[model samples]
Target: MDKNTIIGILLIGAVIIGFSIYNQPSEEQIKAQQELLAKQEADKKKAVEQQKAAQKKQEEIKKQTLEDTTALFHQALTGSAENIVLKNDKLELTINSKGGTVTKAVIKDYKSLDGAKDVTLFDEKDQSLSFKIDGKEQNINTEELFFSASEKTDSTVTLTATAGAGKTLTMRYLLGKDYMLHFSLQAQGMEGVFSSKTNAVNVEWNERCRQQEKGFTFENRYATLTYKEKDGGTDYLSETSEKIDERISETLDWIAFKNQFFSAMMIAKNDFAPNASLTSIPQQKESGYLKEYKARVETFFDPTGKTPTELEFFFGPNDFRLLQAMEKESKFGKDLKMERLVYLGWPLFRIINRWFTLYVFDWLTNLGLNMGIVLILITLLLKAITYPLVKKSYMSSAKMRVLKPKLDEATKQYDKPEDQMQKQQAMMQMYAQYGVSPLSGCLPMVIQMPIWIAMFNFVPNAIQLRGESFLWIEDLSTYDPIAEWGTNIWMIGDHLSLTCILFCGANLLYSWMTMRQQRDQMVGAQAQQMKMMQWMMFLMPLMFFFIFNDYSAGLNFYYFVSLFFSAAIMWALRKTTNDEKLLKALEARYQENKNNPKKVGGLAARLEAMQKQQQEMQRKREELERKRKGV
Candidate 1:
């Protein structure tokens, strides 16, 4: 039994060993495994070598690029910048190659504030323009890099600069016969030079506006920032504010720094980026500068440097007709609506000025009449147009005057406070009987107030009146100084205007004449109050004399002429009106109203309703008093 068991065990063990040997890997398989391990080691070493070589190559490339940039910047900074001059009939521009900026601009047809020299809109010390461009590894400011200038003519110039290898930046300017100048900026082969992170080119423009007019305060009031949005309306900064900082969220068409009579405007062809910003700061009175303006704008710049940007600049006077023609002609390929820069007034007054006053003034100007005479004619036309209202106002006053005697008699019959309501009722009845309304005179004057305010705003801002001479005045736009006190005074300026004096004198005379008529009509405390008010009215003209002493001579003259005309018209009306006849007619009207009370529903019905309301209110008050007194 042991032998058989042992043999079986040995056989099983040999079979198991043979199976294990058969399942074991062959020599070829072992050789293949070793070869694969060797190949993997070799491949890992090759990969490391490749990485090192690539890193070294990249370092070399970066070093070379840094060197090239340094050399280019050195060249740009070392060279002496040149300048090119361009001129036209209206302007002279001096362009510098350093920043490719307009260093100086002279207006040919304008004079300095003192009128002693030709006007310079801006000089090198007053302006700065720069462009910030994103570079591959750094940012570049064009203002610090010198540019090479070529292709200069009487009205055109070109400036160019090399940004990097196969890359260039260029600027061109073309002056026109008028007050406009065309500008263009271009970049070429800048795919590798500029960064791909953004698609905007940042621009900065700074300017300190110079004073070009005789009056600083007057001109400063008109200085402001005006901008037009693309596909939208125009807007402006607050002219009366001290400082302004505006961030535009809409695409912009143009930007302007407008002074009183002149402006410097920049127009973009393709529109500015939506995130542009503008700032304005007014200079102090002692600074001699009109204002300080700063603009930070972004424009589209092709990352691949294929497209160019075009712009236009206007440096000229703020003439209404000229701006209108520019808008009509579409000089910028779109209506710029530049005429809106003129501060005519609000919508209603603006319409009046645009459709009526401006046209009439132009017509008179075309006739070669003096500005003073033109204003006189305008006043006469206005008076003629409003004559009917004036006549009605006078007739109402006359009717009121006719009823004064009867009103006094009625009022004298009631001397107690309890009878005050009854006395007022009687007076109202008398007025109704005479067919007179207290509001009639006041309403006509209220209707004419807009015209007066329009004229007040228009005359001071009229560019046509500037430097115009008439009579003893040399400039109708400024105070016609007849005397100088040699010292500045509050409210009253150092100089006294003859036109202001004449205006105040005429106003006082008008007030006296009107107060005389009112004194004759009023009685008791009313008369006393009116007498005090008449003195106050005289003081009003004196106050006006102080306030308007520094105002425009044309405005003062217009007011004086208007008051003169009013006094004359009022005097003539007083002379023609017959008091006795008016009283008789009022009596007849009273009888007729009594006979047909239902048909007299105009003023009498309103008075009757008012009387009833007063009586009811008095009754309620008396009832409340009785309840409180337990009577």
Candidate 2:
């Protein structure tokens, strides 16, 4: 799209967004409103009232079990179960089933997937599991059952544990169940293993039961198969599977399933709550934006016992090609597609990265050149390609700068708020006579935002940058190391990351330079707008500190390099574009147009007319504002 069209669209979008946000209800108010509606419905209908009572009773029972299970899981978080044996593999930490259902699976080895010693994998008190397996041991707790597995197989590993009334719990992984990864969970009375269909996986109880209500509840959000059985009754709850794709299938294995994908560590502290999935897309938090754009998979289990839960997990890359091979979600690979905007210059960037990874990084594997340096090279290349456009923008800004003194005079003359509209129109006429476009300078910068966002997503997730070192930073995939005095301090974490700090400083410097130039050339509300821009720019890096602290150092490195390069380019432009020459040229053009009216005919005159119309609109708006304020 053209610059004018893009800017117009952006302005309209901004207005619509502002109106929407202003009209939207707050969280607490929405909750209260829903509660009131529920109450009103209950008061009107007897059936509604009865349903509410039943729901409340079920909620209380569920809450009690959740709390109890969570507590028990917390106790077992640090300790290992008796019937489980833990073994470490290159890819995964395998928990072998000796003879027990996992009361809790606390995979502590993956605390820091980025390979940090201090970062804890699981919250010791919140994430835990409770379950009974078919095992010889009556009461087994796998305190030391933390393992990793390398191979990708659907081998049936038998698990045995104790249940309520002291019943035997037997569950096994069913091999050749599915092409991707499969878990065939079978209990005493349960028949056949549950498998995912096109949209869902049905968890049926016994042989002949077709009723959905009989110990069954399907959860579209979680993609889980749940079955609840008491002496008198049986119940079931099934959750819809989470997003999955090719990358996930490619990297799918035992280790990552437990570590990165599965929050089994949460089970250590007895936190068995499933990760939020994209069931209600619109109502979902913006935090899930990336998740929806990318790929995710998670699993939850409940083995009926004093503590009934043996959780299995799967987390890894979203490999679209690999997912296409899997039958579960034929759409998994289909949905994990990148947008056109996302692919802007992406092909080039990927090619460059691949070359570096395959050729450069390989040759110099040990002596890691700083990622910061790599970023500088990339910035230099980008700047070279964009130099022509950058120069044009700079020239436009320079022309505007020359006209500023005249604009200031016009502003002062029509200083009254009541005459603001007249003043703005007069200023536009002045610009027309001088041949200047105020917004031309902002077009290039505005167009670069999408590219910036694309890069932001790329560098953080890039496997090439992970574990690679640059200067004092040990891991390019994580925060820079520094001397730590304490732990968990706000912005100043234990040890401040060097790249993030540098990025913030660079941002402040860039903002200061740009603001200084604008302030020198602006007046009235325009000057105030410049000040606001300055404040926003200054606050941006600080705002990102928390969010980006854990991000790949390569991203921070890229920002720092890009800022420095842009500033350098700006400085060069200022030096090359002579103010005197530009003023003389503008004056010469104005004189030529005035003397030879034909020189300003056709399209130029039409543009001048449109500019005049826009200025008139601006004046009218200002007049309305003044009348509303009674100025």
TM-score of each: 0.83, 0.51
Using TM-score, give the best candidate's number: 1
Backbone clash pairs for candidate 1 read none
Cα lDDT for residue 194, model 1? 69
Candidate 2: worst 10 consecutive residues by lDDT?
206-215
Error of 2 at 26 (Å): 16
Residues 233-333 of candidate 1: C-alpha lDDT, one tens digit per residue: 88877766655448889999888888877788888777788978888888875577788998899876776757777778877778888887655433468
Candidate lDDT scores, in order, read 0.80, 0.45
Q: What is the lDDT for 248 in model 1?
A: 85
lDDT of 1: 0.80
Model 2 lDDT tens row, 283-308: 12212111111112233333322232
Lowest summed-lDDT stretch of 10 residues in model 1? 69-78
